[model samples]
Each structure stands twice: as structure tokens, then as C-alpha cells.
Target: MPRNRQILLDNRPHGEASTTNFRLIAEDTPPLRDGQVLVRHHFLSLDPYMRGRMNEGKSYAQPQPLGQVMIGGTVGEVVESRHPKYQPGDKVQGMGGWQEYSVVDAGQPGALRKVDTTHVPISHYLGAVGMPGVTAWYGLVKIIDPKPGQTVVVSAASGAVGSAVGVLAKARGARAVGVAGGPAKCRYVTDELGFDACVDYKQHRDATSLAGALKEACPGGVDGYFENVGGLVLDAVMLRANAFARIAMCGMIAGYEGHPIPMQHPQLILTNRMRVEGFIVSEHLEVWPDALKELGELVGSGKLRPRETIARGLESAPEAFLGMLRGRNFGKQLVQLV
Candidate 1:
């Protein structure tokens, strides 16, 4: 058995998460039991949702237990298997956590899924063609549902989920606008990801100023919105939203650090008669087949090209995750464990 390296949640965060909140350890891999498979992880996904799990509180999901491996998605190869269904060298994806290896019970439904890297890369099973892509699809297709010529806006538009949202909207014949932090990110959102226009949120100090920039980008009032970073970004979008506009509340990264995010004019929802829906993608498992099919086709056809920012080594996961939370990553933040 190979030696396994893992990072565990050492403590819950008080205000903001830091590397000290995690502890790394090495352990000998246990022999696989009947119907068990051993996976040697090649890539680990670092997402913003993990930050929310670091705090002990009530959330859509259970809090990440202290002293346990930090929960995350992983893509890897099956090295050893006692299960009849799994064979050695098979590419698989699962909730392998922050570890270099995983022991999965193959009998458990959805515990391990074989992936075909013929068209889509295996690492992408954790990003564009996996959870994030499905997240974007559900928010935009189910909630926002933009029409042709309508303007759709998404915050954190250079990120994994937001980038896909903009492209998917454009495929539906809607004009996609983006709001990102820096000029480089904004440029990539427009030029690379094919967003119609992008607004640099850093240039604006207040929501009013940001809203002004949004007005310029979205000449036609925003008909649909995908909210990732709440706070001022959400405020700005709300100000420019058209009557009967739809808003998909995906994530509020701005308030993830135990901060209060008060809406300046929440009454705008009532005034505009907008439909605002908050959703958890996991809860909508019924849509996964349809969503993954469309997303897979888009990626395989070179229509939806998503980028990635990778950190090498398992030890790099903490800082890389922190950098992603601060918006330092260009695309999907991943840790290369191999």
C-alpha cells in the first residue's frame, strides 16, 4: 500500500480562513476490502464553497467536521480494486477530499464514476464538464432563462461557473455581459470567453458607480442576472435590472467571511417585479443528465473553452484555495496532486 498524504480541517475559522486552520499528515494506506476501490488522486478541486464549510454553522450542507479530511472533488486513476466493476488504471472522479489517495466503496451509488477522456480532459470532470458547468446550466437555464437579444449579466464572470454562464447565455442567442475584478480578467471575459461586454468592478468604488458602468455595458437593461459575488455587485445589478428580470442566486462570496451584506435597495425586486431564486445545484440532481449532455457537447465541440489555474503538490492546496477566495485565480483553481 502506498503512503497517503492528507490535509484535515484543524479548526473552524473565527472571522477569516487561514492556512493554520488546516493540518497535514501522512498515513499508510489500508488494504481494500471487498467491493472497495483505491484511487490515487491526480487533481483536486479548490472551490469557494469550501470556505463556507470552514465555519461551524447552519448552511445548505453539513459543516465540514473538524479533524477530518476537507471535502472536495477529485479526478484520479484506480490503482487497486476489490470490486468486480472497477479495474486497475481506470479514470474516475469522486468526492475524494483533500488527499493524495482515496478509498471508495464501489457498491455505494455515485461514490465513483468512470470518466472518458477521449474528448474532455479528466481534470475537466471536476470543472467545466462537471459540478461548475452543471451549476451554471441550472442557474441560467432553469432560473434566468434568457431570451434572444435579451441582456444577461453575471458577476465573477472569469471564474469557472460564471464563465460558463456567459457562454451558455450567448448560445441561447442572448447578449452576455460580465462583471470582473481587474482589467485583465474583464478583458479575458470579453475577448476570450466571448462575453458581449465586461465591466471592471475595481474601477468603481461604490454600487452607484458600478451601476453606472453596468448601464454602459448593458445598453438594454439587464433581463437576467447570475449572482456569484453578492454585496456591491448584486446591488449594482439590481439597480440596472429590467422589469420582470430574473436573478439566480448562486453564491455570495463577498459575504463568505462572516460579514454582513446588506442590500441598499432590496425593494427594487418588488418595484421591478423580478424573479429572484436561490438554488443548490446538488438538490436538482434530476437536471444533471440534460445539463451534462449539453455541457459535454459544448466543450467537446470547442464552443465552450474554459481555462484553469493549477497549483502543484498537495501541500499547495491551502494557499491556492486562499488565493482563489481573494480572486487571484484566472479560472478554475485546482491542485495537482500527482
Candidate 2:
């Protein structure tokens, strides 16, 4: 019997997710059907969105069921195939979940798409040149519509989606300002990521302090806001926003712990005449082709540097995920399964 190592959701976390919510197990790999392909996952994408799925209620997607493989994006090689489209040694991307191996149906739409690693690395298909990259494109291009010489502020600016948001804003001739958790992340955002400025949120925890920091960083007032970390960060930006400003409300990691994060300034939305919209990247699949093309070119040319904080193995995923929720990981979090 072929054994497959897997991680299943053991507990539906009531407040916040921890290692206790997950368990690792070994299972026998079933023989592939005629239309099936066996994928040996090389890299597993660990995203903040997975946190919401661990909860009980449905917000945007279905809640992750207990005693099953944790859901996520995976980039791997096709090891065995009884399918017509895919054969052995082909690199593909799929929803392979958290496992050493996965058997997927080749007939499924969006099941497996072969990727080109000649110009770009395969792992990037899980991050920059993939979901996070296109997500940044959709939020920036379709929602924010940042123009040259405008000031754009990105929350959680050193993480996967947020980091790409800042880079995309800058590429479009906007002054990018990032908000991160600590001084180191602040420095990385400014010095390395080439943002105009960065505010260390840890230094200014309260709403008053955060507002002051935003005031100094965005002197001309913010024209565009790419929000990934909600809570006080969202509240702070609203204080000094330019009239008719646009905000792409992405993720709210701060309130993901089942806490209510009331916006301190609802009147600001009215007074500023702001456009606030929230989106899920998967819903806007039409733009992936163009988004991926542009993002891939930037990444290939080293213009858009995609950073990763890779954890060693599958067992490290639970700890890595927990740490990521706490803002410990700097960039795209990945568990290198192979």
C-alpha cells in the first residue's frame, strides 16, 4: 500500500487558530482512475485566507470541514497520469490541499494548468506570478486606479498580497507608503521594497498615534488605499484621506480572530466621498491572463521582486501558519513539501 502523509483540520477554532486545530496523519494512496493524475506537491501556499476557512461560518467560501485535508493552492509535478492532457514530468498548479500527494481528476475545469518555468520559477505560480500577483492587479487596476504622483498607502505592506500591492502602486507612478508591524518590517518595506515610507504599527498602537503617523507619511493626503490589514489601520487612513479617494478593502487580518473591528470613522467615508470595495481574487478570474502576463514580465526582469519565507517541510506548516497570523513571517509563506 502506498502511504500518503496528510494534515487534516482537527478542530474548528472558536477564536484563533493554533497547532491544536490541526493533525498530521498517514493514509494509503488509492490507485488512480482512468481520468486521474497523481501530483507530488513541491510547494504548498500558506495564505491568511486559509484562516477564515478554519472557522465555522461561511463568509465568502465554504468553511473547511474537520477531519479532512486542509485546503490550499499547490504547485507540483505530475508523477502519474492516466489523463489525455497531462503526462509524467509536467509541472502543474492545482488545489491540491495539504498533503504529500494528491489524486485529481483531469476532466475537472481549472483542475490543472501546466506552467512554464523557463522564464519564471515554478514556486512563483503559488505567489507573485499567481494568485497574490493577480490579486494585487485586480485591486490596484480595477479598484484603486492609482495615478501618477498620487500617494497610496498599503496596510500589512510586507506580506504577500500587501507587498505586491505596494510594488504595483509604485510601478504605476504612485508614491507608495507601507504600514507594517515592527521596525524591521518597516525598514524592509522602505529600504528593500522601495516604498516611499513605512510606518511601524507596533510603535504606534492606538488610533491617535496611527493617525499622526499617517499624517506625516502622506503629506498630500492619500489618494488611494490598498488595505490588507484592517482594524485601526483602516481607521487611521480614513482620517486624512483625500476627497474622492478610493480604497480596495482586501483582508482584515487583525479582526480574523473572531473579534469585532468597528471602524472608528464611518463619517469619513461620507465626508471624504470615498469608494470602499471588498473583493475575492478568485471571483475575478477573467483578468488572470493579462495580470499574470504583466506580473510575470516584471518578476522575470527582476523589476518586481517576490520574496518568500519558506518553512522546511509539511510538519512545519501548522507552526508556520500560526506564526504568519501573528505577523511573524515577512513575505509569502510557503511550506516546501518536496
Q: Which candidate ranks first by TM-score, i.e. highest? A: 1
Off by more than 4 A, model 2: none
| Per-residue accuracy of model 2 over 1-338 as CA lDDT, tens digit each | 25889999999887878899999999888999999999999999999899999988869999999999999999999999999999899999999999989999989888888999999999999988888888988999999998899999999888878778888888999999999988888888888778999988888768889989999999999999998888888888999799999999889988888898899989989898999999998999899999999888888887777778999889999999999988889789999988
Off by over 4 Å in 1: none
In order, candidate lDDTs are 0.95, 0.90
Spell out the clash pairs found in candidate 2. none
- The whole-model C-alpha lDDT of candidate 2 against the native structure comes to 0.90
TM-score of 1: 0.99
Query: Which of the numbered candidates is closest to the native, going by highest lDDT?
Result: 1
Assess the local accuracy of residue 22 in candidate 2 as a C-alpha lDDT between 0 and 100. 95
Query: Tens digit of lDDT per residue, candidate 1, span 199-254?
Result: 99999999999999999999889999999999999999999999999999999999
Residue 237, candidate 1: Cα error in Å is 0.5
